[model samples]
Target: MKPALKHFFDSMGAYFGRPGEESLEQLYAEHPGWDAQRGRVAVYGDFVRGHVRGVLEKIFPLVRGAVGPEAWSALVEGYTLTRPARHHELNHLAESFPAFVADAAASRGLAAFVPALARFEWTDFAVFASEERAPERVERLTANPTLAVLEHPFQLCAYVRTKGARAEPEAGEELALLWRHPELLVTYYVEATPSALLVLKMAVEGLAVPEVAAATGMPEAELRGAVERYSRDGLVLAPGGGHG
Candidate 1:
């Protein structure tokens, strides 16, 4: 494409989400062809914006629903203006939405619950789309290798699992474990206790069972049982010849 045409299209894409009268005037001034086609350009802008909104709705249904239509529309518009889609793949577009919402919440003086909910929704979305990897025998525990751990001030996992019906926000720390089930080919979430969280953290840090016990003051027998259960449940890969 010609440089002028390319710039016009790029600016048009951005305008779809954040249309300003000045921008429209500038666009027409630069590209006289668009002046005659202002109506068409407006329609196209709305079309593009609608497509983006649809994709975000699918990715963050719970959030969209919770915030209501008007607020959600404004949020999407503002997000598009500030954090415009940079990735070609739509799936990657909202990768930073949780943090974006968190920042927006702080700036707007919204409740703390908003960011927590955003994080939980993103966790579910990420877990569902994450690539499935075969467990490889590594010399040591480099990471959890399967699960994604999220800590929130509320029981966000339960809130999301129940579709925000039964679970209410509680004032305390909550740990969520999200992982894909190998056999079932589905993502699952579970609320984990602090002890389980510690063990998993230690494992991810490449600690041995004895080291984990010493660090956490957890009984060796209990640690062994936890490790065995995690291995069996596919939270971690089956034990290799290296450190547990």
Candidate 2:
């Protein structure tokens, strides 16, 4: 009920499991050495922390799984404290984790292959809920929509590619194409080239061959070739074809 205690609880709730400090007192009263000043500290929250921690843990499981328990806990501590998500929806919350990996991989340091592996896994669920991919392909690619459906807001995601035909980490910012299909399947793949990435992107965004070709400075025949490549890869599909 008190502000200091309330503040402590809300902070705890962010990391723990409660609506506020009052809840913390009620829930964690039996814990060792619990007091007014240290109502619910980081360690306490970790014991009770749920959704966000669970999601991040899944993302970095390979990193964690490879390292085992003690080391993984330490890694998780770094991620939860440093890269907290404010959004209520946990499924698509790892949008920032890729960027966080970039920072940690550079500064705090991560297990080798972590940055690439994390980026690949991070965007897996997001493509479905993302705004970039159009919902229900246009019956007529050229005609205007009568109901005025808005193309979804896009999510910027990254992917990894093998170097020299092996799982070599990208030396720099890797070019990737991530988009949701009508079936809500989020797919990721390494872009062969910048042009290839851009062309594939345009294809997934529901751009027609001509528009994409004009925008990308490729010949229609070439664009068709690229679209077919995307189709072969199962990244994009024919208009009248089934969604997803």
Candidate 3:
């Protein structure tokens, strides 16, 4: 009835379940209330949470697979509590949960791999959630890891691979990609450090095989082979990418 009460109830919807139908009617004197049905005050409420959880389940399958069911639910609950998604799209709802894993790792730092692993998974997701891709010179073949040559906003999706003497992937950490357009896809491409550079080349710098190989220290033959593999997979494409 009043703005204050309405606001309070709205906040309650987010925190508690929707006001119980009884409480809803009793408080607002409405004929009926959402409480009678389900009460998930999530940003997406019930169905959306299911959608997001499904997304998370798919994207973080290894996380679920590794952590197991009970632990997976705990991770999801903790994620929901600490980080309420701000994104309007259910597609991107799990965006920052990787950081959540990183934070959790702070205590034990034991499962350090979980951080990059989670983030790697998120990349594929961002690619799929983002709008259509622009033309890149997809019609070329090279081992250039950087030549992935995507357009901005779609470029590497804000994650980059780190290298050099100072940068080394810990045993637990992994590099991954997340993508979902026509279908949801997440991949864990295990490769030697140099091979991993091939992935970084395409994802981070958008370089084609030759260009990527030139930039990276990996041998030309190896780089070329890697690019061939990636390009064939649709992960790496002709220079003119995503555009008709």
Over 22-54, each residue of candidate 3 has an lDDT whose tens digit, in order, gives 533443343245454333333335554465577
Candidate 1 — number of clashing residue pairs?
0
Ranking by TM-score: 1, 2, 3
- Indicate which candidate wins on TM-score: 1
lDDT of each: 0.69, 0.51, 0.50
Error of 3 at 125 (Å): 1.8
The best-first sequence of candidates by lDDT reads 1, 2, 3
State which candidate, 1 or 2, has the greater TM-score: 1
Instruction: Give the worst 10-residue stretch by lDDT in candidate 2.
Output: 143-152
Residue 135 shift from truth in candidate 3, angstroms: 1.4
Which lDDT tens digits does candidate 2 get at residues 1-244?
A: 9986876545554444333456545554544455545544544554445556687776555545544576556655555665355567775455676666657665554555565556556554554455554435434322111111111121113212221133234345434555444453545443446555555466446577787777767899987776666544445554565453
Candidate 2: deviation at residue 109, Å?
A: 4.1
Residue 147 accuracy (lDDT) in model 1: 69
